[model samples]
Target: MTTYTPPQRTATLADAPAIAALMRASVLELFPRFYDERQTASAAKHIAAIDLLLIEDGTYFVHEADGEIVACGGWSKRNKTHAGDGDAADDDRPLDPATEPARVRAMFVRGDWTRRGLGRAILESCRLAAKAAGFTSLTLTATMPGVPLYRSFGFTEVERVMMTTPDGVDIPGAIMVKDIDRPDSIGP
Candidate 1:
């Protein structure tokens, strides 16, 4: 069994380029399993860019090993659940923790680090942080290859969303949601 290490710290602006490169590598190498080349490339171009606001909000995290970032992901208390850097609009208003589910955004792993529990580690960090922020539930728009991982983490399919890239390419994804349990009800 692989032992996962906790993320080093919340992401910062300086980490954006590395995170973006990792996202591109992960997408190019993994997305092909579920998407055609055109679809994969289009989706990569649209999605690999990180939202700087997430890092600014201090919710984004990155795990490093051997002096390099191996995994990255985060949760958001904002209305905009998904978007790349250049794609984010002005409607990214904060969400009320009491009324809305926190969003799990921008999960990506280095291609060589796949299936090493790194993704799950970052996910647990997001869940715990979201729960502590008073969110009772979480939601994320999962790329096709990410469905199984989200399912393994107890998220259920809530809806299917088709995102049209700026170049007019439609990428399919699923909205997955999970309810967070109170500390008292969590099982060992």
Candidate 2:
């Protein structure tokens, strides 16, 4: 069994670039097996999709070994998908602190780090961070290769998300959600 060292704390701003590069490597190398080249290159690149998501909301986190980045993940207080309120202009309400949820925006680990449990560490870290930030549930859009990993973390299928890239390419993804802190139970 491979032993993985867990991170000490949440990621700092300096970790963003390395996190982005890892994301790029993951998408470029792993995504092509499941998604088209266009989707991999346009929508899944590190700087384009991940950098803004991380630097803006600052939900991104990273795990490093010997000063080298190994794993990363993030969650956001805002929902990136449209709420489908019938009116695209429906009164946009700020997220409710009690019931509103945050989302897992991106997650990745270096190729050499696979099977070392880095992914699980990152997922647990994201869940703990989101819970500490007062979020009850977490959501994320997963690519095909990520389905098993997300499922192992107790995420369930929600929907298929169709997204457009900066180059106007359509990227297909699976939507999954998980309640981090509470286990599913019947009402008493």
Candidate 3:
């Protein structure tokens, strides 16, 4: 018997709905273990949204199998570090690669696809793309369920943060960073 893996490609505007669905499902199914009910629900409502800027910037990606998007993620050269951050005014500002880290944003994998290297594969693609664009480092705000994956990819927690949802629920998360230009900072 053989297993077939779907190939990843850049996401388009047409993929937004599928990518959004995958992100919401990934959060709702995976976050309960690390967060309370309210936190999980709030995050699913806010953080799991699709950032159209990533798609327009050609930085978002999706892995489709049988015409269904099973996994999605992306890196951004823009100033928006994450969705639902409540700073939409400056979200589209381009980051200076020489002075700022590129952002690894909006990563998601279907619940059944956990531990299958999909997250790592997306991070590797992000790293290479950011490097090619002259960024020496990468940064992300990782929800609790995603901490281990980011750590395994050489990201270090810079600080703990609490994001307040529109409904005023506080969700705890971490800001992680990786100096991708370092020789020892290679992806897992």
Give the best candidate by TM-score: 3
Q: Which parts of model 1 are misplaced by more than 4 Å?
A: 1-7, 85-90, 182-188
lDDT of each: 0.83, 0.66, 0.88
Cα lDDT over the full model 3: 0.88
lDDT tens readout by residue for model 3, 1-188: 45566898999999998998998999999999999999899889999988888999999888888999998999999998786546668888999999999999999999988877778878888998899999999999898888999998889999999878788988889999998765325444
* TM per prediction: 0.90, 0.79, 0.93
Model 3: ten consecutive residues of lowest lDDT: 179-188
List residue ranges in candidate 3 displaced over 4 A. 1-4, 182-188
Ranked by lDDT, top first: 3, 1, 2
Tens digits of per-residue lDDT, candidate 2, 1-188, equal 54657564467776667766777787777777777777777745422345354445656677788887877777766655321112224223345547867777667777677756677667777788788888888778776777777777788988987765545677677888888785322221
Winner on lDDT between 1 and 3 is 3
| lDDT accuracy of residue 32 in candidate 2 | 79
Worst 10 residues of 1 by lDDT: 179-188
Worst 10-residue lDDT window, candidate 2: 82-91
